[model samples]
Target: MQVQKTTIPHWSEDDRPREKMMLKGRNSLSDAELIAILIGTGSGMKSAVDLGREVLLLTNGDLYEFGKLRLSQLCEIKGIGKSKAVSILAALELGRRRKEIQTEKRPKIDSSEKAFKELRGYFTDLSHEEFFVMYLNRANELIQVKQLSIGGISGTYVDPKIVFKYGIDVGACGIILAHNHPSGNLKPSESDEKITKRILQFGDLIEMPVLDHLIVTDNGYFSFSDQELL
Candidate 1:
């Protein structure tokens, strides 16, 4: 006779994944354990944690890489069906949104590094190119960050008038421009330079300053002000 596999329900409370979570807390669980809670079960022989390990193993145990997986790719793992794959993707999307929400809080952005950190969170959900501008008070603290336009992977159109107009409407003293390079190229292209110049000209016309132009990506960022390109 074959021995039945031990299920999570059968394990003692502390040893059980869900119970372990309730007792200790979320941080107390490992990556695999957290995934196991999403899974709840596995193929006949493998336990939930085992299936979770397989999920991580498929992505080489990189959470960043894991978040980038397509739903169909996630379903490739044994015992992970359409429902489980959707759940995983939903959780990852929620995490990204949380980062964005945290950034929405007012923060002083005095340097390019600080601006990049504050603004990059807005780009986490973008798979294509989009432009944004951060309005700032005279003190260099952020007033608001607003999307200018969206485009295909190659580039985006940023109308200079709308950018500065919004800043004026919001009573901003200055603005910082930002856009994402979906190809992960941190270098600002020729068009990027031309647009920056155009916006700077408009800002000059109005006495509102274009303080910086940032080309940001998942890996890093490029800054016009830092390069003295402005």
Candidate 2:
């Protein structure tokens, strides 16, 4: 009688995810294949690639949606234990940090366009509301980016004192405030306008200019400075 080989063992060496990535390059791999490489192996009856396909299905093939998944949420999926879920989350965070570092290298925020380009990536994939501040030096170079608050999908609160305090702490001469509307609306609410004016007034008193307030959504952004609202 002929011996039967397991599915993974039967896969051609060049066709294996890790080997394929090594041979063809990472960009050549599909999303499922890349996830399979991270997952390492699969649960009962599923190949790693097959399990990865299921995960992609769960996120509707959007990597940003996948990135938002919590460890507990990921663990709920078959074949994803705590270890595997942690690996995926760690990988996603590393990618985010890498992008942040690259952006920081070009930290100039001279115009609303530049500010939007720099700040949009941080808010693009978030499911909840997050208010962030980018502190700038005298020359408009970014000193640091800090998250002021996180709230539910509808809105988040930003303390003017805390915002200025971060500016003082970072020795920032100017600052740009930003937050995302998860609903993908670029229109600023009344509260958004009120907060921007308040922060602008406070910045004037502190000698730290509020360069802009950006309302970012997945599709686009609304810039207070660009619209002469700041």
Per-residue lDDT of model 1, residues 157-191, tens digit only: 98888998899899999999999998999888999
Please give each candidate's TM-score: 0.89, 0.87
Candidate 1 global CA lDDT score: 0.88
> Tens-digit lDDT track for model 2 on 1-230?
96553555569987788988899899988998898889999788788888788878878998877777888887888998999888888989988877676542747889888888888778856889999999999999988889899999999999999999888987999999999999999999999999999999999998999988999987888999889987
State the displacement of the C-alpha of residue 182, model 2, in Å, after optimal TM-score superposition: 1.2
Query: How many clashing residue pairs, candidate 1?
Result: 0
lDDT: worst 10-residue window of model 2: 98-107
List per-candidate RMSD values in Å: 2.1, 2.6
Ten contiguous residues minimizing lDDT sum, candidate 1: 97-106
Query: lDDT of each model, Cα atoms only?
Result: 0.88, 0.87
Q: In candidate 2, which residue pairs get closer than 3 Å at backbone N, Cα or C atoms, i.e. clash?
A: none
